[model samples]
Target: SIEIGENEESAMCIGVAILDDLSYPIAAISLSAPEQRQSDELIESAGIALMAAGRKISEQMATG
Candidate 1:
């Protein structure tokens, strides 16, 4: 889930759940940014980047 900070204007976070071969939880990737510098576009971009990073990590964990 992506959520805003409690202050609403302090931060933004996007998290991807990492899973094992059985699809059980293993770890996670969280990208956070200061809300002041995070516009809607920026947040969306960050989310995309986070997803890409998460994919890379999963691939490494699976094959390496």
Candidate 2:
């Protein structure tokens, strides 16, 4: 799960869920910017990146 917060007038800080095997978010990634450029596109790209990151992490944990 990812949460976005309007922390500033020109940016939104997003908190990403970093989970463990238990399906709980044990960590997170936060980022902010001066408004989202082409929000739809940015969101899609971010989704892909997060999914890839999550999959890689899961694979590493299962193997190591």
Candidate 3:
């Protein structure tokens, strides 16, 4: 994620492990933001959103 934004002054990234159908960690989910465009509150919001997404993906995999 070093240059994912390419032209940003500063960026933040947060990720969570993604679990397989068997509940094993098989991948990951990452959320990124450009510091100049995001406030600390926004970054926190994105972190929560990222976690929620990971949980939803796990739930879907478990159901399917």
Candidate 4:
């Protein structure tokens, strides 16, 4: 299990990774903020995006 966030002053992204027993990431989320938008609000917004990403990946893997 891992969570990573990147803030480049102007832009930011939040990421989360769920690893398998073998330490391979089974699912992951990567969210990007709007241009020149780096703040607590942006982070909060990214969380929702990341959550959707993670769920989408998990569903794809489950079906495939």
Candidate 4 residue-wise lDDT, 1-64, digit = tens = 2123334544555677755545478666666556454666766766777667776666666566
Per-residue lDDT over 1-64 for candidate 3, one digit per residue giving the tens place of the 0 to 100 score: 2233455447666787778777898788887666677776877787788888988988888788
RMSD versus native structure for model 1 = 2.0
Give the alpha carbon lDDT tens digit for every residue of 1-64 in model 2: 4334544655655455666776776665555555645385786677678667866775566457
Q: Which stretches of candidate 2 lie over 4 Å from their true place?
A: 1-5
Using alpha carbons, what is the TM-score of model 1?
A: 0.77
TM-score of every prediction relative to native: 0.77, 0.60, 0.69, 0.51
Model 3 alpha-carbon drift over 4 Å, by segment? 1-9
Worst 10 residues of 2 by lDDT: 1-10
TM-score computed on alpha carbons, candidate 3? 0.69
Candidate 2 vs candidate 4: which has greater lDDT? 2
Better of 1 and 3 by lDDT: 1
Angstrom error at residue 7, model 4: 10
Q: In model 4, what are the clashing residue pairs, if there are any?
A: none
